[model samples]
Target: MRIQFMLNGSSETVDAEADTRLINVLRERYHLIGTHASCYSGECGSCIVLINGEIFHSCMTPLFRVRGMRVTTIEGFAKQHAYKEVLAGFREAGLSPCRFCAAGRILTTHALLEISPNPGEEEIAEYYRAVKCRCTDFRTYLKAVQYTGRLRRNRHRVS
Candidate 1:
């Protein structure tokens, strides 16, 4: 079947099977490798992608589900202003996630901040739970979120 959707900021159409996972189409068909396929069961969160402003585990999500919807992988999210600011904040806060979990965490953070720009520590913790990062402590990631919030506020204040 042919599915059409908005990818990043452009429209995309591809032929895929009924049971094909979104991650497969993304990585294999479109070559959008930023959305990794870790646990096919969706427990790893490594395959997380934003679909219509919400995070979905692409590994478990069917391609037909995203048909006509907007899907944003880490590659697409990287071009966003929020991504840029959050990344800078991560660096400034000395928060470094391993490559395996970084993209998923970033996407989760972006979704959280987009929904709640001034989220409290509890909220940050709650959202961070979506991404499993066994190698790093959550403190640095939380600090980065706080810093990004501040940066966003400052930018809005000047504009």
Candidate 2:
């Protein structure tokens, strides 16, 4: 199958099996290793990517499903200014997620912030529940999300 989609802000065209996992095409074909491959079954959020600005597990998403859609991987997202805010928020909250789950955590934070720039505690918890992090505690994750929201709001105000 020939899948064409907007990757990170660029148009991409690749011939792959319709059943091929989006994660494999990203890591192998595009060398975008930031979208980690684990628990190929969508149970692990490690392979999370933004499909048209919404979170989706690349491992479970077939290449064909992304055709004509927009996909944003961590590598592409890291290039944007929002990624810097997320990193700063993590730093401010002293929340260092294990490398195994960093991509999922960061991407999830971006998605959440986009939906609610200043989300409440319960909202933060609900959104973050999708990403499983064994290294950091829930409180730290909450702090990070809150801090990121603050940073985003501040940026918006300044602009």
Candidate 3:
């Protein structure tokens, strides 16, 4: 099956099987390896990607489901200015997740900040619960998200 969709803000088409997972299409066809697959069953948020501006586990999403939809992987999200702010926040907070969970954590951070530019601590903790990063403590990651939110809010205030 030929699937067409807007990938990373660009129109993209690839031949894929109906049963093929979107993760495979991304990593194999497009070489978007930033969308990792840890628990292929979606139990882990490692394969999460933005589908039409929301997070979805690409490992569980079928290629056909993304037809004509907009998909954004960490590679794509990293190109945005918000990514720079998030990176700065991480650095300021001295928080760095392991390579395994970095992409998904960053994507989740982007989603959370996009939805609520000034999310409360509880909101940050609530969102971080889904992203399991064993290497780093939840407090560190939560702090990073909160810091990023603050940076974004400050940027908006200045604008």
Q: Tell me, by lDDT, which candidate is best.
A: 2
> lDDT ranking from best to worst?
2, 1, 3
Question: Candidate 2 regions off by >4 Å?
Answer: none
Candidate 3 residue spans exceeding 4 A from truth = none
Q: Could you give candidate 2's per-residue lDDT for residues 1-159 as a string of tens digits? A: 798999999999999889999999999999999899989988779999999989999999999999999999999999999999999999999999888889999999999999989888898887677777688788999999999999999999999
Displacement of residue 124 (Cα, Å) in model 2 is: 1.3
Question: lDDT of each model, Cα atoms only?
Answer: 0.88, 0.92, 0.86
Error of 2 at 125 (Å): 1.4
Candidate 2 clash pair list: none
lDDT of 3 at 25: 87
lDDT of 3 by residue, 1-159 (tens): 888999999999888788899999889888998888788987778898999988888999999999999999999988999889989888887888778888878888888889988888788887787677686677787788888988998999899
**Superior by lDDT: candidate 1 or candidate 3:** 1
For 40-153, candidate 1 gives per-residue lDDT tens digits of: 998888889999989899999999998899999999999888899888888888988888888888888888888998999899998788888686578888899988888988
As for lDDT, the candidate ahead, 1 or 2, is 2
